[model samples]
Target chain A: MRNELNRVVMRFPSKSINEGLARSGAAAFASQLDPTLDELGDIRTAVSEAVTNAIVHGYKDEIGEVIMTMKLFEGDEIEIVISDKGCGIPDIDQARQPLYTTGGAERSGMGFTIMESFMDSLKIKSAEGKGTTVTMRKRLNTRRYR
Target chain B: MKLIHDMKGGLLTVRLEGELDHHCAMDITARICELIDALLPPRVRLDCSKMPFTDSSGIAVVMRSARAAQGIDSRFTVAGLCAQPMKVLRAAGVDRLVEIEEEVHI
Candidate 1:
């Protein structure tokens, strides 16, 4: 792990409405790194996907606590970890596949795919009936002179 | 998010305003599907010009809307998407399912 410059930990309810709050909050915090507009959008979208997964898939039919930790490292790197203490995923491999959703018809099952594509790296850890944690990292290459 | 719909000459255009995410996806899908079923237009256009932000949930909304239109043999199109939403749609291969017209800048 690189030397951490800053960090923030947020704990919120697994309410559907908090999805927006989580993403926007992450984006706002990341703005300090002077990310480009496109980079900010990617970070926001990735955070949204991970948070949505915690709310919808992790705690299906119930409300649980969701924890999000944002860390800023040297060299404009941002690492985000979203975890839920809801029902853990049975198969992380199948769950990561594109268009493979246990979330039924309304879910596109593209959450992990989006997070993987938008971020630099994605890591998932889960144990069935225990919980799930998603960690994503991205390094923003802004041309701004420091 | 705000959804505005209008039907003209068998074509229905629904413009989405504000961020589209899991919070509002169910309502948006419901409203769009209801309009499609009620009007049964020959062509449906989802105007995403004002919708600047979205995640995978937006993809589900588009997919469900397209399915609704397809059920009635209606052509569905998504137009004027911003960069982020467009990337998501393409990432999910939704562009293959529906016609897409990116925002044009002069």
Candidate 2:
């Protein structure tokens, strides 16, 4: 199933990361299948928030790379996995709280909240010494093909 | 996305074309804010006749624009929303904040 579907992988450094690239990447990735604008927008927002989290929270002042792995599932579900090998979040629970941010100027703390609002399912895994990984899934509301 | 602004009869009309998604929110936000600040008309109308689709982020941007309009005591009206974008906007409770009109001149 994975082989039959298309995949996109990207690695971006935190210092150079911005919203435009993240939005464009998700749009171009979803454009591979020519999805509806609403669906494409949903995917783009999720990707942007994930990448922003990596750039703002995960890396902070440290230099690191944020990797994104995207896969189309059975041509109906889109799954994206974003990982960053930077300073991991100490409290995953607090980080997911809406409007909870640690950084004063550089963060809005709505990244995860926005991602969760746009995607169907969101999963996060992190360790204090390791890194943070965010996996998001959304079902494409186009015609389903078996 | 493309934006065209017109001022007539002391009303500022903004015509938007193409998809309003997360990708275009920054530009849209900036343009709308600039127009509102610069023009300060009695009524500001958003003509979405050509808008095909919009997501939550797009809706949020519109909401923010409406709030900004309110802050300056300017009337905000969203017009010519198609079925799809209208459904999404209403479901998200955006229609409650901004006046939705069926007749909008582009």
Candidate 3:
């Protein structure tokens, strides 16, 4: 939030189907920077993971709202934060581990890994019984975007 | 998202278009499992070239398909993955497990 040049905030219900909505909304807002196809794809994937985490783990079976905030900073850096007021992660370190999935079966537990790989920085904050927030930042190598 | 299944020479290829996310993965997973169980093709191929975007849920789709194929003891291959699908598949080290018909360099 510090030294932010531009920003967008949106909130939606914690439904499984809203995963696509959140991803596309973030990608559409990022498109103003004219990011490359690969860059856009990375942004899309990262948002999808964050929103999915909110819906799948944060809310579990209950219904809630997911708040998404996007900020554009100098040097063409784009930052995104997905937050939820649902059950928070009890073990942040363990949950962030690659292949560590609380959602059994096909989850693959690669959500954070994919977000970390695609974005420049990924920060997770949570308090048990409170909520969890995930913030990701990436500097769009802006030469082409400019 | 839309899914199409085609059978040729005993090989069943599933072509996916549009975005694949948690929204549609459930039905896609069920359809994939059903197809594989019923047809029991010698080989199954997933076409991702036309896909615009895919996420971790898409990974679940692929895994479910692989499991379904395994249930029938059939070979499975992923073909024409580009952009998003390609990046995700590589990072999950899925290439180490499933066969990619086209070379996808991470």
Best by lDDT: 1
Tens-digit per-residue lDDT, A1-146, candidate 2: 44348789987777533555666787787776667877776777677667767766788778788888888777477888999997889998999886588754324455677678778999999987678999998877673342
How should the candidates be ordered by lDDT, best one leading? 1, 3, 2
Candidate 3 Cα misplacement greater than 4 A, ranges: A144-146, B103-106
Chain A TM-scores for all candidates read 0.96, 0.88, 0.95
DockQ, model 1, C-alpha based: 0.84
lDDT of each: 0.92, 0.76, 0.87
lDDT of 3 by residue, A41-98 (tens): 9998999999999998999989999999999987788999999999999999999899
- Residue B81 in candidate 2, Cα distance off native in Å: 4.9
lDDT of 1 by residue, B2-106 (tens): 999989999999999999998899999999999999999999999999999999999999999999999999999899999999999999999998889665221
What is the alpha-carbon lDDT of model 1 when measured against the actual structure?
Answer: 0.92
TM-score of 2: 0.67
> Which stretches of candidate 2 lie above 4 Å from their native place?
A1-6, A14-41, A56-64, A73-76, A86-91, A94-114, A127-131, A139-146, B1-3, B16-31, B48-60, B80-92
True contacts kept of 3: 0.71
Clashing pairs in 1: none
The TM-score obtained by model 1 is 0.96
DockQ of 2: 0.12
Name the candidate, 1 or 3, with the larger TM-score value: 1
Distance from true location, Cα of B106 in model 2, Å: 3.4
**Of 1 and 3, which scores higher on lDDT?**
1
